[model samples]
Target: MFVTNVERREERKGPPAGGRALDLLGKMERNEREYDETIAYALALASAWSYADPQALHDVMNSLGFENRCYAVTLSNDAVSARTSASLLQHVDGSAAILCFRGTEPASTGARLADTGVEPARLHAWKAVQGGVHSGREPMARYIACRLKRAMNGQSIVDEKGELVSVDAPACSDATGEPLEHRLKALYITGHGLGGALAALAAAMIFEDKEHEGIRDVVRGVYTYGQPRIGNEIFARRCQDTYGRLLFRHIHANDLVPMFPPPSIGTFEQFGHELRSSAAGWVFSEQPARRADTAPFGSTVDVLAWVKQRLPLVRRLQRPFSSDEHAPHRYVSVSQRSLRLRRSELGLSLGRLRG
Candidate 1:
């Protein structure tokens, strides 16, 4: 049966279309050693493309032989919060899943406001979670976690006819028609900007859920691009303790969104490894750089202050092109290029070993 808010169409089905998704998934299947970087870059590309068009993403997944394995869900906008959208893509063997959240929409005033709002919120769903998270993101993260749990549990939803309908897609089940919890191994979460922040928090929410104990460990990784700080130091510590090297936050060249809701305004902080984009490729760091003397300041105000103090004339003449820095296209382009180079390097290393 179809999921309550999730849309899964079955009208058009065909063989794998051999697109980027198929190519990347093929690489994973062919070489286990490359899975980590390949999957991360694949998710990064998917996250950036999701903001432009969700349907295109569905089509891409379908071409990658996902077919009925793809589902898109959208939570309606309320007076208080803007609409939130997410998509789930499952591997054909039920071995892995990717949950991608749509980033902030430019046309939505509510989303724009949420990006700027620095308020803290402690969600009841998070149980005894140590600290508060971005008020704007908590609810959306909770919603996403709940839906993912339902999909994994193969829970049913009531249709308009007042009948219980199984919401499990073929990807979530085995040939015996049973839920594939055993086969369901790895789960990857990803998004860009506000969506990235939600992806990070949703992983935390899933872990905090006792009911999700069966599936929480399946959360293999959380890959976020240009995401603002989602929670405070305590929350960050808990996440770092739980995910460790599995958590990756990618910051494209000078992305302004990632440096937001300054620590001065709230206790917010970023945890996990940082993948700062460079001309050479992605440079990995233990944590994000925040000091004024370092690159990638903690907030927009810090950026302005740095510019004003060091080069007032340049600051006045050329205002920070913050939006361009945060653009989804930039993330997509850089990630794809980096992935290519990574593959080339690995190939050369293999050749040397063979020699």
Candidate 2:
């Protein structure tokens, strides 16, 4: 059975050429403290970007004093009904460029009603790529890479009066008319939940696209919160090889998305130092977590277990309740100002990232 649009690829696989995905963790950048300046800054930006409105998003960024007037934003244009948000924002002072992605909207509850088979969801799972077991393309990653650039030029269906956005769209004259990828500099990418998953894929996309070497390695860094697994082990290995110490994946306790979509079967794996959330804040480490049945298949027992997991009673039994942990607000409750309204407080309402 298909867990969602992204399913376990029972056929093709990514070649097992790359090293263990966990090995890449050793090479990831370390955050000495969870609430340090860097993380605080990143989480704040992530919260701001989650919003569909630029003036509002920028206001959050502006309050934090990050100058980014020109931005390129895009939401998913796929038929899967996956609502995605990817944007490139340049710092007003040009210190570092920020690409912020939005996670599943809080209003998207798993049990929420939808038309026919269309359940309210945020991510679009991809089929197996040309590679082997550990090698497969992440669909959302590919979508973001293709659309984010033109999106900067207001090439989006949302077309929510791009002119009304505080950030200006991309212009050919800006990067000396060079390809958008070549002009990216001091780039920092961050996302939450599926947004985090896409940001992870988005980061790897640039690094793998050596043709766009300008953006291939020029990224200042990458940070994600409660992100789901996007690709196979080979993909994780590739992310490690490409981003290396530049990547950091942060997970909160009981955040199911990060535990998701199965690895052995789905072939998806997470790479980078695992920053586990703690009562004090976040704790970083280079470790492989227990394999979760993100997309349980094969036996009827497994399917039954998956069904049992969704019951409200089961959720009540868990700590950090998936709902609270998945939201961007919980990730940045340390910063009170950033924890307000729909931008930061959305997750507290209701949401889901599918199974």
Candidate 3:
């Protein structure tokens, strides 16, 4: 059944009249199944580009309960380059940090290139990573890692132009005079769409590269929405074995992006736990939905056929395009509804046990 405009509005607004706004940071648990709503909602908001302004990103994050949080740091290859864009925000209490990557933007040539370059490339002699990975995301991942290393070391973060960028507050010392790394409790990585793919790759780099080992223990988790398959079987297995439990991939129903570069092509695979959002609630699955065979290297005939197959469903939804389902707002809507439903169920279960 198609969702009506009213339902979509309700999903975006949250809580019928005045129960309470969904708590953005309350009841946060390290475990996968519990206390995920906050992470899901926060990360979904974190994915948006929102003018690519550090101040704007900081304002959005502040609204999500990051009290007195340090200013956000925006990263790109250069001042005028659109090759990469990501934001880093550290909590005021120094308990956590969030690195959010910008999803693909239609106006961005760099984003378009990153989205299309999904072919696997081997990286055997790299400092830490050693296997086949997405060609487009690898370099960006390394760049992020390098910058993060500098930030953790208390050095000023700089863009490619070598302009000074803020990593945390100017003082670089907490209330207790401890270093940023010493006070940091956890690091959370997130993104949407293509950004999600980059988030996964970044996490892999942190896990495999010894240079980042210092902050590895503080990596709380990776939360992503509508991310596509990023690496080959060997790379997938390595990450899955190492920090699979820390990766939470959320896919809303029929989001076409996650289904791309199908497993049939080049041994590409998605690893880690997947939470599929639907009207019923969030469905947990270890296996991804298998898509129809898509010929390698963007075969025009096969690609057209695939698009044609989903056209009917897309039309029924009244979407502007078939890819509309992959929009960040769509994921946000689904996550809000699923979280409310799950919370309601948990309340009822608790009530029954009490009775």
TM-score of each model, paired residue for residue: 0.71, 0.60, 0.72
lDDT of 1 by residue, 132-247 (tens): 22444544554445545544655321111222222222233212334543355567788887778778877776677676677675676788888777766777778778764567
How big is the positional error of residue 118 in model 1, measured in Å on the Cα after superposition? 3.2
* Candidate ranking (lDDT, best to worst): 3, 1, 2
Candidate 1: stretches off by over 4 Å: 1-23, 26-35, 63-68, 106-113, 124-182, 291-321
At residue 20, candidate 2 shows an lDDT of 33
Q: Which of 2 and 3 is ahead in lDDT?
A: 3
In model 1, the number of clashes is: 0
In angstroms, give how far residue 12 of model 1 lies from its true place: 28
How does model 3 score by TM-score?
Answer: 0.72
Cα RMSD to the true fold for all candidates = 8.5, 14.6, 6.6
Report lDDT (Cα) of residue 337, candidate 1. 62
